[model samples]
Target: MDAALADCRACPRLVAWREQVAREKRAAYRDETYWGRPVTGLGPADARLLVVGLAPAAHGGNRTGRMFTGDRSGDVLFAAMYAVGLTNQPTATHRGDGLRLLDTRVTAPVHCAPPDNKPTPDERDRCRHWLVTELGLLAPTVRAIVVLGGWGWQALLPALTSAGWQVPRPRPKFGHGVRYEIAPDGPGRSSLHLFGCYHVSQQNTFTGRLTPAMLEDVFAQAKSAAER
Candidate 1:
């Protein structure tokens, strides 16, 4: 996975798009490496409670390399994770920023920056293979998964469903703190607990759609469910 991300050239369009953004937004991340390349997964490779986010923002993950860093969404998400004891760091401003996870790990469906914050269906399809591979490696030890938005939920459904688990009728519709069980495909394997929440994007916060308290409550629930 690390090698794939480090040398990612999967989406030429995204590669060109990111380089353009870097050139135009040069001053913004002048002092930083502009992680404009691909942002592989971050956090412990074996930690439980994996967080599935949508994708990296041009200036956020694209600039910082660390998921959910250097942007408004990251500011909101990390604060809540800190409050719930999920992360050791309270802020995520840049890579090598001393940020660390406690019981949670984070990843995205698309590892590379997409054009205009949106990836085509084909792009997403190509990216899901990494997600599937990561899921299998992380699933055995993970207790719960916190999927940030509806797209993330949809991307992962097929994998869980094929494993003989009844994924959610009407499919676990997205809403903060909504939890469901991914019944095991095997006789004795543990079930995968799933939770949903907003993506913590700037629009959601600035528009008054999701407040700090609301986000915090969802994190609390995720932690408790993770422990259970």
Candidate 2:
């Protein structure tokens, strides 16, 4: 599934921007090769918890080829996950750095890195297909989801509804530590518990908008919901 996602070039703007960043290269990582393509979600197949992020950082996942890797945002996220016993390690420096997630899958609304860390509405809508497919495949085992940031929270709802989950007519708003339970419309499907968390971006972390304990608390809630 991920292999095909990595090959997508559906958005011309994203395609060009990612490649341009790769070529221009950051001064500190001039010798490193950038993946410069769509990034695939990562985690175990039987994951009970799914984490949704906004998009890849220009020099983070775009360079390392793994979601949330090689950046301060990743450092904060993985460390919190580790503290909550969802990861084997507390840091995500690179793809092959021996990091592992337990019963958790991490994905994003957009795959490619966007300029100024923001993807236009059209781009987000175009990228929704990938997430829809991914959510459908994980529907069986995924009992809970942790959406990081407003973008991912908003992006996931329509996809989940398309994937067969029954969402409310008036969608719930996004807020840190907010949770909404969606019961399955059809038989043979488990109920989904959605938890919201502030993005682990540098802007939030450095400003202390999202602290380690706060993130861990959300993960703990997600874990508990997954187990139930």
Using TM-score as the measure, the top candidate is 2
Please report, as a residue range, the 10-residue window in candidate 2 with the lowest summed lDDT.
182-191
Task: Quantify all predictions' global Cα lDDT against the true fold.
Answer: 0.79, 0.93
Q: How many pairs collide in each candidate, listed in order?
A: 0, 0
Pairs of residues at least 3 apart in sequence or in different chains that clash in candidate 2: none
lDDT of model 1, residue 99: 93
Candidate 2 per-residue C-alpha lDDT over 1-228 given as tens digits, one digit per residue, 9 for 90 to 100: 888898999999999999999999899999999989999998998899999999999999999999999999999999999998999999898878899999999999899999999999999999999998898888889999999999899999998887888989899899999999997776556899999999999899999999999999999999999989
Candidate 1 residue lDDT tens string, 1-228:
777765777777888887777667757567665767778788787777888888888888887777888898999999999988998878998877889988788888888777777888787877777787777777667778888888887777876665445676777777777888887665434677888887788778999888888888887887887788
Ten residues in a row with the worst lDDT in model 1?
159-168
Q: On a 0 to 100 scale, what is the lDDT of residue 4 in model 1?
A: 70
Q: TM-score for each prediction?
A: 0.92, 0.98
Top-scoring candidate (lDDT) = 2
Q: Which stretches of candidate 2 lie over 4 Å from their true place?
A: none
Error of 2 at 100 (Å): 0.8
Model 1 has a clash total of 0
